[model samples]
Target chain A: MALVELVPNFSEGRRQDVIDKILAAMKEASTAKIIDSRADPDHNRLVVTIVGEPEETFKAGFAGIKTAAELIDMDEHQGEHPRVGATDVVPFVPVTGITIEECTELAKRLAKKVSDELGIPTYLYEAAATRPDRENLANIRKGQYEGLKEAIKTDPDRKPDFGPSELPKAGATVIGAREFLIAYNIYLNTDDVEIAKTIGRNIRHKNGGFAYCKSMGFATKPYVQVSMNLTNYKETPMAMVVETVRNEARRYGVAITETEVYGMIPVDALLDAAEYYLQLNGKWNRSQIIEKKLTEME
Target chain B: MALVELVPNFSEGRRQDVIDKILAAMKEASTAKIIDSRADPDHNRLVVTIVGEPEETFKAGFAGIKTAAELIDMDEHQGEHPRVGATDVVPFVPVTGITIEECTELAKRLAKKVSDELGIPTYLYEAAATRPDRENLANIRKGQYEGLKEAIKTDPDRKPDFGPSELPKAGATVIGAREFLIAYNIYLNTDDVEIAKTIGRNIRHKNGGFAYCKSMGFATKPYVQVSMNLTNYKETPMAMVVETVRNEARRYGVAITETEVYGMIPVDALLDAAEYYLQLNGKWNRSQIIEKKLTEME
Candidate 1:
């Protein structure tokens, strides 16, 4: 089956009633399954994860965006995380039997629909970005809600690819397609947050480290963490990252406490590491998995 | 979905027409997918693998057995491999969301139906065996067709589990349930068969080795092979076996040339090894897989 994963972030998280209404509308409007939903009071935002065929996923995404636009007013929103709209960011990821190009097209279609129908401006980022300047989401969401509200009226570069030039009460949503991202974090034995911050800066892509990694360091009580997003596991696998971090940690006289996978990951990402460590000879395909064959039959 | 895998060995493999007929009948019978089929001319047997929901899988397995019994006659059968019937052995395996006990129940239902409707005596072996001696398939298939033909009528212990004690024209079928078995083989750098034999003896369960392994040694061409059947992967995983064999081979001044997995394997088997090698902290699950979540949603 052609499967796509949709992960969208909303501005409201402190209120359960609004979150429930948006979730209810998403579940009712499309056949896609909402696998995971997290509401963080600190971030004051909600992150919802869903997966299904492209057509159904698009409809579900649109439904959630519509509900978020109706229920949340960005003027009243406050969060620890960056945001530009009530429904902040919607990213389409290729799961199985799907291509990045196909996901890009799906993102564009959803962006246009949400913009035209909901009167919410939308910017395409990542693989579906129309302009080089808007390729990265952080770049498009540079000013946040307040700054973007003024910039949209004065700057031509700030004008969205779709919807009216003026920002609506719901603000603007950033929609795009990208490869599966693995949110991995490794904790250090010592409670030195500075050590973690130094390692994170040295290993992240933006700081000239692994090509697809974005990392930061955080102090969470007992231990310090080198938190990261592996944007493309195929490019820089889990083992390589873990080992590099381990070697880097040794310099600070600290050991790795443990590593964690934050969310759902594609099977191939782990299988690739398995094959490498096991030294499996020759070629092995996913068809060799009984469940994979069963899924294909379905 | 409740998934069950059926691997049936048919007595007639030399004749293409008969094998094709049985294969076609199996495909037409139910929605179960035929994953693989291999006809061994020397053994004069056909091993067909199929997997689906329990009900449909049972129907397809029955259809294949009925077709094999119709096209094959025990009186004229001759082969290198030992067999007691036209449809020699049918093993039901639990693939996903199903237990060995559930598969044992499925095997018994298939056995009773085949015995009563087709007038073919059936013996339940392995997990579904009524007698301790019948638990091992090699023991149940002892004496072959010619020897069992006379013994079933005389020996009380030889009486079939279902149908009449006397053998039919198609002979008797052996049906049962068992855990997924992994057939793995390792080739040694040296051509010394005795080294391979000694290692096999040391690693097999019967010789006080790993509890779930059954191994043998064979000299094929330039290398000697240590062939094994891992009956229960959860008990004795692939990494443990490979490491054991590697340690044993070092004693003989021999290195492992390569290792191979024979057929389809459960994803958990490899994932288990991945976790051990990677040292993933805390509890990790198949739910972390995007495809697994998709399957669950279905």
Candidate 2:
């Protein structure tokens, strides 16, 4: 069976009871394994990472979005992070034996179902975008919940790919497909946040650094950190990024204390790092990894 | 399912039909994946790698050994490698969620079945060895087929562990349990075979080097190679070995060209290498690896 990773963002984060209900509903609805569940009180959002076959993953996302729409009122929603609906954004990532093209199709179907049944408008972003303008998530979420409320009815440019121009209290949800993202963070020796910021700006794609990289520096107490999101690890590997950061840190006379893989990372990403560090070549066959061979047999 | 890896070595490798028959009988008898099957005509031996749960893997090994005993006459077998039986040695390695102690139990059961049903004397080696002297396979296979035939009837120390002290056409089989062995090789920039040999000796356990490592140097045409078998990678990781070899090559002013992973390897071995090379700390969770998470759910 093909494996797909679905990350669904919901508006309710602070309320443990509400979050539990939504998670439980989704778990009961599908056979997918919810590998990660992070509820940030500041962002006022809950991000759930689920892995399973395409059909079950789609079901889990739908169930989660449906539960969130019922519990959360977008009209009263407030958060540190920008969002558009009760179930703000759901991105489907290709995990094993699945392609981006296939994930895009799955995203389109989820968008249609949400719009049809929940009456919550959906905007397709990234690989599933109909127009080039909507490919970037920020472009689709330009106005947030308040601005999009009026813009959806008046502005043709703000019209979603699915559902009516008007939205319910739940608001519009951004649905799409993207490559596996590696959340990597490099900690600096000193507590100077500005130094970390300078290094992050130099190594991130937004600042004309590595492509498919989004990074920002944070004062994470004991050490200043350059937190990064590698949107496409296959094209822009973790090793190249870490080495570049190492070089950048050396310029400021500040050494990196350590690096952190913030969440569930694909095994290939780390294997890439090992290959680069060990200077291993063609003789090493990735298929020879026992677990991978067992997966093939399965 | 508790996964076990079984590597069975047979006496006949020159005859394709004989090797195919032995392999076919094993596959037909059990539902195990025959991942690697290599027949070396020079050694006149066939080594087959099978992966499956305990019971099925036991069935597969037994079937292959039984077929090999029927087809291969040990008295007529001659090769570069040492051997005492048509089915020389069968080693059961714990792959996933299984301990060496548990694998020792499995190996003993298989040895009993082989000795009882086939009447071919068996001696347990490695982790399953009854005596400390038999812990090393080289000690058990000291005299090969010719010497073992007479020693079995004469010497008390040469008595079989499982069956009668009488010799059969198949001779004796060494059955045992051992940790997953990683077949690793590193090639150097220069074709000087002695440089590779020195490096190999400096890093191998047999020559007073690293623990759980067996290594040698070979003149592998384009470049001299340092070949190794890492018996217990959990204790002595791949990163430590690779880095040591890299440092050793530096002394001789020779650079490492590349390294080869000769056969199937456990995922944990590479992950340990990645963690070391990447300088990744606590934030990374091995359980978070998507494929591993899927396997855990299963």
Chain A TM-score values for every predicted structure, listed in order: 0.84, 0.85
DockQ measured for candidate 1: 0.54
Clash list (residue pairs), candidate 1 = none
> For candidate 2, lDDT tens digit of each residue in A141-252?
8879999999999999998899999979999999999999888898989899999999889877777999989999999979999999999998898889888888888888
Quality of candidate 2's docking, in CAPRI categories?
Answer: medium
Q: Estimate each model's TM-score.
A: 0.86, 0.85
Question: Given candidate 1, what's the lDDT at residue B142?
Answer: 86
Best by TM-score: 1
**When superposed on Cα atoms, how far off is each prediction in RMSD?**
3.7, 3.8
DockQ of each two-chain model = 0.54, 0.64
Q: lDDT tens digits, residues B56-83, model 1?
A: 8899989988998899999999999999
